[model samples]
Each structure stands twice: as C-alpha cells, then as structure tokens.
Target: MPPLLRLVQQQGVIMSERKEGQSIEEIYADAVHWHVNTGGETIHAKRMGGRFRSLKWWTGSLWLLFFLSPYARWEGHQAILFDIPHRQFHFFSLTIWPQDIWMLSLVLILLAMTLFGVTAVAGRVWCGYFCFQTVWTDWFTWLEDKIEGNPIQRRKLDAAPWDARKIRLKLFKHSLWLLIAILTGVTFAGYFTDIYRLWVDYLTLQAPLVAWVVLAAFIFGTYVFAGFMREQVCFWLCPYARIQGVMVDKDTILPTYDAKRGEPRGKSRGGDEARGDCVDCKLCVAVCPTGVDIREGMQEGCITCGMCIDACDSVMEKVGRPKGLIRYMSEKEMLGERLPPLYRRPRVIVYSAIFLLSVSGILYGLTHIPPVELSVVHERQPLFMQMSDGSIQNKYTFKAVNKTPEDLRLRLSVSGVPGLQLLAADGDTVTLKSGKTIPFHVFLRARRTQLKQANTPVRFRLQGIDKPEISLEYESVFIGPSKA
Candidate 1:
C-alpha cells in the first residue's frame, strides 16, 4: 500500500475508537464499576481527602470524649455517670436524681430540635459528619481502605478464593473491627456504671449480665452495621432519613450535581465543544459511599456526605476544567434563584424558634434543679386522733432525698397550725444519706379547743444543720373529722 493510504487507514482506526458526545445511557453502560446496593451486597466506598473530609475527621473526634469522660474524676467520684442502679445522674459537682428527671425530657427535646434544625438547613450534615453510625462506618471503611486497598481491591479480595493471604487480611481487619466494637460497647456501658470497675470486671470475666449483654449487643451492632452494612443503615434503619424530606426543601443546601453545567457528557479525547464539563468518567459514582449517582438527582440513598463533590472536583481539576461539577447547593440556588436569609425562611425560622425554646427550657431546668427533694404524706387511714392530753394529733411521714453527694443533717420542724407541737421518734434532727431517700414518722399535736376547722394547712421545713444554705420545705394538710 502507498504511504498515504497506510496513514489514512491508521487515521480511520483512531477515529473509530475516539468516543465523542457519549450519551447519558452510554455513560451509564460504561459505569459497570459501581453498584447501587439494595441489601444484597456490601458497599466499598472509596475514601478521599478534601475540606469536608477533614471536617468529618474533626467531628468524628468528638466521640473520643465519650470514651474518656467515664475516666474523668470529680472529687474522687466519676465526673459524669448515669448511675442507673442508684437512679441518679452525676455531672461534676451536680447530682440529678429521679425527681429531676424532667430535665432529661428537655434535654431530649433540645437534641431532637437541633437535629431537625440542622437537617432543615443542611441535609444530613449529621449523617455526614457527627452521627455515630456515620462516624463508626467511616472508621470501619477507613480501616478497610488501609488494609485491603481501595474499593476495587476489597471487592476482588471478597470474591477471591480462600487462601492464606486473604484469610490473614480478613482476620486482621475483622480483629480490629471487633476490637473497636468491644471498646465501643465497654465505653457505652461505662457511662452507666463505674468505668474503671467495669473494665476490671470485664478483664476478670466477671462483668454483670446486663454489662455483658450491652457489650455483646454493641459489638454485634458496630461490627455488622459499621463494618458490613455501612450506608444501608442510613437508608433503611434511620427514621431521620425518611423524615428529612419534609425538613429539607428547595433552600436546603446539599451535595448537588449542577446538571446545567455538567450535562451532555463526553470523553476527554473527543474534544466535543458542545458537551458540558462531565467527562463520563463516573468517578463520582465510584467514590460515593451509597453508590447513588448524584446526577440522577437527590435520592434517599444520598447521605449528602460530599465525597461525590470531592471526587467530581478532583476529576474536573485533572481535566483542566473549572471545579464544582458537583457542589453543595440548594435547588433554588441551582435554578438561579436568590436565597432568603436564614431568619427569612419560614422553615428555618420555625426550626430555630423551637430549637431556641428547647435550649432555653433545658438551661432553665439545669439552673433550677433543686438541691434536695422533700415530701410529707399525712397519715390518711386515721386522719387525726384525740390525744390523752386533750389535744388533736395528726400523724405524718416525712421523706427526704438528699441530692448532694454528702450526707445532710436537717432540723425538722412544722408550722402554720396554731399551737402546734412537732415531735419525731428520731428527735428534731434527722440525718439523710447522700443520694438516698429516707422516710421517718412524725406527729403534729394541737389543743382541740384551738382547732377551728376540719382541715388546716400546715408547713413542714427542714433546716440543714451543717449547710444552712441548703434548706427545703413542704406543705400538707392537717386533717380532722368534720364537726357533727
């Protein structure tokens, strides 16, 4: 063949191989690397570094406090403890008893509202950054990434036949996962009991049944959910994901694909000028933890983790194109609509208002938590009896719960019943155990002639003998039979 003919043949071959203006369907066909899971297979999410990735690491670090707090000491006692056995929550200098459980409700409300408000503003920011499920799953995947290489290597290993190398890697990875799971279980249990003692018990194989159960459950959950289930937990198990639709709206910013800027996908070698920025690479799909293509539009499987954004940005940078092929944006912003201020959005305003109210209530409850709880129950079976000394006597039972860590001595007395005399079997002073409720019988006597009504309001007060500032009072009715 002539030289020109040979050159033309080579050019024809090159032209036939050069892919241009690849339709979305063709791109989808090329993306055999990713699978959108539906509870059938494990997802191996590719991990990469970016601004949001660093932010995720920082937020995940907060859970370290959960592990370390039980070891913290406050005046020779655990700094923070649930103390479920004793029915008290100790926080540094403050002790909360069952009487103050109302505060916990406010605390729950505060947390719930905060989650709602954040979701309304930025979709699944918690799932991406702070949620324990997400954090633990990220950690598990990170470990997997380090040990098994990237997602492709992990899948290959998974499909590889049983062998020494594979077994060794699997064993090491699972061993570390189980270690973390056990630590998570123990750490969670520590919050309820003495952490040091709990550790000793576990070491000695003497942990209580409940402690063992908690450890087993957490271990199983962490290993399965974080190590195996990964993002599927966010998809199916989490109620927040389902309800976040209502919380998130057109203004809610999320990891979004700019279809206007990224559509008309083509290949790098094609040089198709009509095509948008996307190169049909599917790097975004490859990097997604949930395997949902952001270009398909926002779906429940999307955790809004921004990994896709990072992946897309990296791809764009490599292609010598401007970044933000996928970016954090709202639907309205994508549509070129001006966004209202946070205070102006009705959803945001309502969420913020409720969040503020919940926070205020929690703060109020914490500040106003009574140092002690006192109750007096008038003996109801007999109401009142006539004493031999020509006085009407009322029997009462006084219960006092000392919220403080130290024992308290209280000078118990009564008033508001004219000519009334207070008497107790244990004398005028009673000692209360720290964080324990003690009940004692008492008597109130008044001259029958001085009694003017069938029911008289009476006041019971206890003055702290050692701590005069710590005092409590209760009011009760001194009842007698109605006049015939």
Candidate 2:
C-alpha cells in the first residue's frame, strides 16, 4: 500500500482510541464542532503575539529584498539583470550566454530538492513563512486590522451599512494595497530594464505597453488575491497544498493537537476532575488563518502556521494549566514511539543526495564559464574543392562570441590534418567584437598526398593575442576526396 494510505490508517486508529474505559464512540460524543470554509465569507483571523508570530514577521521581511534589489548597481550596469533583448543574464561580474543555459536546469533541481527535503522534515513551513502569497496576504490583512478593526469589529463593519466612515476606511485600505501591488510589478520588470529609467517612464506615463500591462496584471492579482482571497488561495488555488500530502510522513513534524491529553474537554469550573486540560475556549479556531480546528486532525486547509499552537498555549496559561496542548510534533512522538534521526529516513537521504549534486553542478558551471564561445562549421556543399596545384582545399566558417566587455584580439590556427595550411585574412590576427557573435570565412588547403581519407580529423585553435591565458578549441572534419 502507498505510504500516505498507511499513514492515514495509523492516524485513524490513534484517533479512534478509547479514553479512561469510555468507548471510542463515547469519547467523540462531545468532540468540538468543526466545518470546512468554502469561501462563503471572509475569515478575519485574529492576530496575537508569540514566538512563531515573531518568526513569521522576520521571514516575511525577506521580501524587502525583492523590492530593493533591482536598484543595485555593478560595474556601471544594473546588477543581476535578465537582459532578454541581448540574450544574456548578467550577475555582477559573470555574464551567462545561451550556451551556458544548462546551468538553469541544475538551479531548478536544487530548488526542487530543497523543497522536498524541507517538506520531509517539516510540513509546509515554506508556505507558512516564506511564500509570497502568504507574506503579502499577511501584510494586507495586518493593514486591514489596523485600518478597519479586530476580527469581530471587522466582521460587524462588513455587515453594517456603508457610511462615510466605512467608505473612507475601505478607500484608504484599497489605495495602499494598489500602491504595493504597483511597486511589486514595477520592481519585477526593473530586473529586465534600467530601473531608474523605468521609474522615470512610469512617473511620466511614458512607460512602454508591456510595462503597463505587467503593472496592471500585478495590481489586479495582488489586490484581489492578497486582499480578498487570502487563505482561500492557499486552499483552492495553490497546487502545492494539494501535493503536500504526499510529501509528509508519520515522522514529519507539524502543528498537531495533543488529543490524548485534551479529550473530554469542558470549561474549567474550579478543578473539574472529569475534564481534560482543554478549556473548550475555541480561541484556536478564531486565531487560525485558515479557520481549521486543531482537535479535528490535520486537514488540507492547514498550512502548519502554528497560530493555533500560540492560541492554545496562551489560553492554557490563563486557566493555570500547563501549556503545549498544540505544538510541533510528529505522529510517532504523539504515539509514544521513538523518533528516528534525519539521516535514517530514506526520503531525507535521497533528497539530500540530489540537492548536493545539483549544488556541485551549479558551482562547476559558474566557475568555468568561458570568456569566449567558439564554433567552427566546415562547408559541406561541395565537401572539398581541388586547387590547380592538385591540392585539397576546404572552406570553413568561424563563429566566435566574445562574452567580455571589451573586444578581443585573437589568433586562429589549424592542426590534426598533416601539412594543413590556413589561408584566411592573409593568416593575420582576427578581432572579436565585444559581447557579440561574428562569423569569419576561412580556407584550408592540404596537399592531396597529405590527406589520408575523405574525412580527416581537424582541430581549430583560437588563442587571445592580448590575454595569453585565454584559449579555446573546436573540432571538425577536413573533407577531401576518398582514397581508394
């Protein structure tokens, strides 16, 4: 059976256990009422102060880099630019051409491995902490809470008639949302163009149509998705939530409710012996961004944000009970089983191996990016032309792309074919234009007696005249008449 199915079965048996001789059915007779929210109404999740809340704020602040990085300068150029028109990706001093695009595959693999490894260790921490949608939605809602009111007051205001006060608050909130959305779009586009000029063009309303389109799309998406959709986007729109079920196992640590200690829950009426630690406050559900109940077991709506843990811990403190009714724990730990180390888990081992390999490949590619890319194409229409001197002559084209900022003075030579002679540009030096691919035609002649076969192996070597450290080679065939 699939691991996911087996995990579900094990959790089901755990949840079905009897408490203090009471039957499984009797234990759930007073279970907390829970229902799935299907977008009928907006969930105004109450915010509170806690360790995880502080961690969320710290993680969300990382997005400030996205807005600020485009303005960074390097070597009199925009640093970390994806210059699509020039077909080059510039990262500080390194320039990547189309030929080195294979590095992108390694980058993607590295990201995938990281995601899988993190998911195997902990559940959906990326979604809760670092996802753009989560962070933006948090910002939008925090603004709403400050401008409108707390969750209760906000809900009441939504139901109340539209007054002048209501209109003013709504307008101010949406205007701020639109401003953030516009900045996000513009900053993203700035990575491809000059940000200083882009800002000027946007302010003057002289930006290009593509820029305007990008700005408009981001404005709509950010305003609607972050401001209105909120957790519904994570529940219904984000594909990651759906696939995360397979990534988690019994050992994965997640925000879990300690049902064994918290069952038979009731309001504390001065040392009620029959009741468990739970006070039945329902504060956990109120603070949950996705409106999920921790006692109801893990659900697809859970992003594992740990807001419920904070709420439950705070409530336990108020009632003079021990904290941690809900906390980060694995099913194995909850079931009184020994938790295995990360290295012992097969899933973690495989993901780590792939992650390291991708990192190694990416490092190799970055360190070995060539200063010049060379290609030699032998003319194949006539294969070879016979000279009046009964010599075999071959025509070839040399295409060299100089990736450097300045022009290169390069010298070309031929080898591999015996008695080969290069008759190009009077056998003088060649100039390669900076950051451009230029083609040069050349002729190669070898005595017919020197040619051993119809296709003779040849190597074209290009060495930089000004920088003697630069050397590049291309292998091709010197076509000639077949020897009988």
Candidate 3:
C-alpha cells in the first residue's frame, strides 16, 4: 500500500496492534482492503441463515397473493379482475367504474404515506424486505447460490474457464430464472383477464396483442433486473432510495455499527488494554448483499436489513464476547442520548396525518360508491315543441350507467313543476344491462300558464322497480319562452 493512502486511512480509524487468535493476522490483513461496492463488479454475497434472513423470506412471501388472487372466484367470475375493456375494476362483489377512479388517487396517497412513515420510523424496511426489486433479487440469488455453490466457489468458477459442468449449471440456473420471469408475466396479465382462460389463450396462440406485449415485457424485465442488476438497481435505479434520506432523521432506527464500542480495534482473544472489541473479520462485508461496510458510517447503500447485525452478532458470539457490535439503534441512542417518542418527530407526525386522511378518503369512497349514475341533456336545436293540445313540450336525452353486476329495471319519474307530466314515461320502466350505459329520449309537457318563467328547474329520478331503495337523480332545466 502507498504510504500516503495508508496514513490517511490510519488517521481516522483506530488501528489494532499485536494481537492473538488464529484469524487475527488474517483479519488485520483483510481489514485494510475492505471497500464499498462501486457498481463495477457483480457482488457475490454469501447467504447465511439468521433471524433477519427468515424475516426477509416471510415478507417476500406476501407477493404470492399477486400470483394467486386472479384465480379466486366470486359469483362465478374472476374475483379481482380489472376488466379494462369494460372499463371496470372488480374486487369480489365491489365494482369500481371509470367515474369512481378518483378513489385511486387516495389509494395511491395512502400507499405513499405508508412508505414514508415506515421509512421515517425504521429506515428502508420496505426496500429491504417488501420491495419487489429486493424480493425478486433475493429469490434470484437463492437459486444462484444453490446452483453455483458458495461465494468463494462461485468467484473461482467465474474466473475459471467454463467447460461442461459449468455450462450445465449456468444453463440450469438461467432456465429456472426464465421460468420464474414467465410466470411473473403471466400472473400480471391475469389481473386484466380471466387467469384460466388467459392460460388457455396463450397455449392455443389465441391471446390478444396487448396481453402478449405485457407478458413479454414483464418477462424480459424480471429476468434481467433480478438475475443481473441486483443491488445496483437499489443504488442507482430506484428514485425512492434517493429521496429516503430526506424522510429519515437521526432518530430513525437503522443497522448501525457502534464505532465507540468497537473502535481502537484489535483481536478478540486477549483483553488487550490498548484496543477495543471489534476484530475486523469483514464477515459483515462478505454477507452484505449491497457490499456496504457499516463500520464506515451509514451510507446510501445500507438497506437497513439488519443482516450486518446478524453477522456481527455471530462474530461476537464466536469471540466469547457480548453481542451487538452492530445493532438497530437511532443516532441519538448511539450517542448515549435519550431516544425521543414517535409523536415528537415532526416527519412522523406529518406522515401519520397524511396517512390517516388518505385512509379516511379511501374508506368514504368505498362506502359511498353509488350503484348507478345518471346524466340528462336537454334538446338544443328547437327549445320547445308546441303540442296539439296547446301544452308546451321539451325533449330530453336521458342516460344511465349501471355499475352493479346485475341488470336493473328502474321506473322513471319526473318532478319539480306543478301539473308537470311525463308525456312518454307514464307507467314506463327502463331496463339497464349490468355494466352498460344506455341513452333514450324523454318528453316533458306542461301548460304555458304552468311555465311561470323562461326556464324552470326540473328533476329526474330512476328508482329500482324491485329494489326501491336503490335510486339515482339528475337536475335539469325546462326551456320555455320568456314570461312577459
């Protein structure tokens, strides 16, 4: 090493001197070489079974619902179909039409606020466990580990010339990854159409162009991203990672290295009075998916997965010392200060307020979505038509959209002016098909004397014939000649 660079490194770091243990010399030798990932090489992270590892597995498993939900049957139909062609989103018995799409804004807000709140409280827990990128990458790496052997072996294999065995393993691993990608694509398309029928269409080569396009795109993206990019996606591609710094504060809990406790570092074998607890094994670095050295202070690459904590704890255990060389702690706690309550944090308070408001809006929208919608347009060409009986008549275009799953037979009624009558709607009912909008003409007639003014306020109502409780209304105007 250059004397200048070594001096610079030693100036800040507490260096170890003269220590015992079989791995002590090796630790000191490798400690000076540990560096962060710079997106230059594929990080071959070692897999270790631990509590946080198990937690990651469980969180990743939540995505199973994305694959399985389209198969669920409700009232003999796909339970969670988007039905884009019909412009309706079906969720079990609930159907959301285009008019109700405003609720999606609130739903999006709720999700965003949830992510912000969680990030503010416990740094990047979503990115570590729940994010699709992290989850898919985890699965992809697991398959790679099983097929390519441990990290050291894998690195050796990469350097070695590929022959028959290496070729076989690479092909097998890639095939499995491609299969997963294809399944992910199919699952995504299933949400827009019937899952069983979609599969049949694909097998029979009868699927639509849009479905094929979506499937192909998802397949390619999943394969390349999860199989190759891995943590680079989090480091460079994800916009949330860039903004997460703004949401997080000193109070946020993160996987932190206790520098004060572990510095002045040396070997763990003897009670060396000149050194602290850290042995500098670099096992924490080896096991890191993102190759972040936690000892360098919190960097953008840390996903707060606590894998370092698990690794450091294991190392401490092996050295016959108390654990928590690295742990989940706020900066305040790390500095031996009192950790503030959640409500005391301004960011948490703001995020919680937004979250609660968005949730309230979503709930209100869900409960208040009407089963039917109505619109009425008065004729524009001829304002009013004179009837043979000398009663002024006005023509109107009435349109009704049925949002319910069942066909509706509704009785039409008009009200507002005294002696007003429905010239065409007397004892008449309109039959509306499920999820269909239909328009028809209606005529309203009244005496010239009953008009009272140039224009009169008119109201139209559609009451369900069988279910009287379900009704829709529209307010319109009666156009007539101006009063003298």
Candidate 4:
C-alpha cells in the first residue's frame, strides 16, 4: 500500500473508534443517571422539614375548607349552595339565577386567566401547592406516616408478607382512608343540596340516583387517585401537565439545580480539593415526592414543589455548608442574564390584561342584573282588527318574569302614538309570581285617524306596585294599516 493511502485509512479508523467510545460513554452515563419515573413502583419518598415543607403542609391543609364549606349556614340556609333543581346559586345574601349565567362565564374566564398568569410567572405553583391531587396525596401520605411510620418503614411493610401484625396495621390504615374517601364524596355532593337534609335522605335511602352516582364516583376517584395513583395522576392523567409547557417560558421561575456549581459532583469530605458543594447524599431524591433526582436536570416529574430545595438545604445545614444548593431560579437568571420585572414580561402583561377584563365583565354583570325581564310577541294571524266602533286594534302577548324573591303587582302601560288606549287588562294591575314569567294577552286600540304608518314603534313599561324599584321596559313595533 502507498504511504499516504495507509495514513488516511488509519486516521479514519481512529475517528470511528472515538465515535464508538463516545457512544459507549453516553450509554454508561445514562445508566448511572436516574431518569424519568414510571408508575411501575410505589415511590417511598422521605419526609423532611424546612421552609418549603412547612409551606406545603400549610397549603395542603387549606383543602380542609372544601370539606367544611358545605356545613356553613347563613340565614337558616346553606351559605354557599347550588340549588340545581331550582336553577339558583345562593351565596350568603346574594342569589344567582340562570338569567345571570353570563357571570359564570366571566368567572370561568377569570379563573383561567389567573391560572395562565400564575403559570407564566411561576411554573405549576397551583399543582405544587393547591391542586386536589397534591393535597389529597399529602393527606393520605401523612396518615400513612402516622400509621406505618416513615418511608423506610413503609417500604419494609410493603415488602413484608401478610403476617397478623401487618394485616392489622394495614386494615386500620385502609379503614381510615375509606372513611376519608366517603367524607370527601359526601362533602362534594353536599354543595348542590342542603347538607343536613342530604344526610337524612342518604340515611333513609331516598337520595336521588344521580347524587348516589356522584358520591360513588368521588369516593372511587379519591381512593384510587390520591391513595394509590398519587404522582402517577400528575404524570399520565392530568391534561394540565401536558399543556403547562406551552404556558411556561424561559422567564418562568422553577425549582432547579445549579448545574454549573454542582457538576463534577463528589462526596464532600472535610478537606476540599476541587469539588462542588454537593455531598452526593441523595437526600434530595430521597425526599422527592415524585422520586425525581433534580440534580440530573429538570424532568416532567418535577412539580416545582421545592421539596428538593428543602431537603438539600437541610443537608447543607447539617454539613455546615451554605444553603440553596437547589433553588428556585429562571433559565435566564441561571445563565447569568438579567431578568425583567413581571410587568415587563409579555406573557405576564397579556395574562394580567385578560384577567382584568374578565373581572370587569363579571363585576358589570353582577351589578347590572335587572330586577325584571320582559318579552313581547305581536300576534301574526290578524295583524290588526277592525273594531265595531271604527277603531284599529293590535294584540300582543307579553311575558314578564319577576326575578325578585317576592310576588309583585305590576301596573302595565303602553305609549306610542296619540289616542292609544290599552284594553283587556283591567285597572292597569297585572299579578306576577316570584321567579315566574306570566304571559297574558294585551290589546291596544287607536282611532283610525291616529294611524300614520303600517308599523309604528311602541313601548311597554311595567311598574311594580309593592316594590317600585322592580320595573322594566320593552320596545316593539305596532302593526297598522298604511295611510291611503
């Protein structure tokens, strides 16, 4: 072989070997790294105390309000009740009827905007702190801790065979969980009906089938999702988790490991010799509720709960090192770039604008809710009738709904052209039932000389006799013969 050709072949072989070595190194590194969590194994995360841990406990306890809110009473009625059968929502002194359902749309918009704004600012704070899955799982795990001890002991119990002592403990824990599940179901159903009356109906086996179905669904869902599924629900079931990536940007702050400072990690000994602060204790992974090794970089399982930060900080304290080995930071900040204020962030600004608009619409809807609603239909069979006295008459069916809580005596009147007279309604008083629409035929008569066109604009006004504040006006066209 020629010397140049041989040298070229040798260089190619060396480069190929280097590429092969790189591939092997990557596979070995991945093997050493803790990757994503699958639902196959039960995660037994260690519990520890720190600022974030305390915050989690406090936020989790806020869910107790959901279980207790149904029992609250005001003015001899459920304070916050959704009377679905009556199509009413009562909140203390305020009543919302189906007519006011637009407010509900605004409310939903407000909630969505708030979620978007918060997600854009801090990633998944709602999931970390206030989500039903997180809160219920926390409660279930706390109960487990009380009954079966910490993560280590819980793992042992899981591995243990069905002995008498194990069976007793397991039975006790399950019984408690079942009770909680039942209570959660009942409380959810209580919101739609009177809580005390529902209890009576349930005990008597007279509750509606729909209510029973809802209770059963809630019970099963709570037991399975909170008690068993736990983090798996966040991983595979929650649609919010899937879409949160789009909502969060690089500016969004999240619980993250400082890779620049912590890489090339080694166990911290008394003597420092070119090593990062990480002691390689694995305490962060041990305390992670989702079994995430945050130091490996952010993963889908990281809920940004800051639990790892708490765990690492406690370990740092114990090892007499400065805290915040794992901390909440934005990508920009982590890359040594300046972060703009929240208002300057485009996502935050847009979300805030939408939130404000939704809130304003809701406020306007609530404040401008009319006391009465009116609809008028002009009779089409015979547009106008010729009276025996040579007068032209028009007939209309008026529907007036009294939205107030009391029955009202309404005085009906019409105004349009000169010489217009109202007939059929005697003494000008029409009775209206509370929350009911009353339909009645009304006739309007006018002299033939008063008719000016084929159709003339007319107004109908209703004034409440008992409560003058309850009034409404509607405009309609009155049909008449065209002038010759």
Poorest lDDT segment (10 consecutive residues) of candidate 3: 3-12
lDDT (Cα, tens digit) per residue for candidate 1, span 79-152: 99998889988999888888878878878877888888899889899888888999998888898899999998
Q: Sorted by lDDT, highest first, which candidate order results? A: 2, 3, 4, 1
lDDT of each: 0.82, 0.86, 0.85, 0.83
Model 4 bad stretches (over 4 Å): 1-32, 424-427
TM-score of each: 0.91, 0.93, 0.91, 0.91
Worst 10 residues of 1 by lDDT: 6-15
Worst 10 residues of 2 by lDDT: 4-13
Model 3 scores what on Cα lDDT? Answer: 0.85
The model with the greater TM-score, 1 or 2, is 2
lDDT of 3 by residue, 1-484 (tens): 4322332233333334333553533544555455556678998888887889889999999999988999999998999999989999999999999999999999899899999999999999999989999899999999999999999989988888989989999999999999999999999999999999999999999999999999999999999889998898898899999999888777899897776778766655375765666898888888999998877667778898878888888888888778998888886786678889999999999989999999999889999998888888999989898888888899998778888888999988889888887865535688889899978889998988898898999999889998899988889999888877
Instruction: Return the clash pairs for model 1, or none.
Output: none
Candidate 4's clash total is 0
Model 1 spans > 4 angstroms off: 1-35, 481-484
Better of 2 and 3 by TM-score: 2
- Residue-level lDDT of model 2, residues 1-484, one tens digit each, is 4332333344442344445776544444433245678888899999998888888999999999999988999999988799998899998888999999999999999998899999999999999999999999999999999999999999998998999999999999999999999888899889989999999999999999998998888889988999989888998899888888889888899998776677667777456686678788989999999889877677778888888888899998998878998999998987889879999999999999999999999999999989998888889787899999999999998888999999999888889877899999747588988888979999999999988888889998888899989999899999888787
lDDT of 2: 0.86
Give the clash count for each candidate. Answer: 0, 0, 0, 0
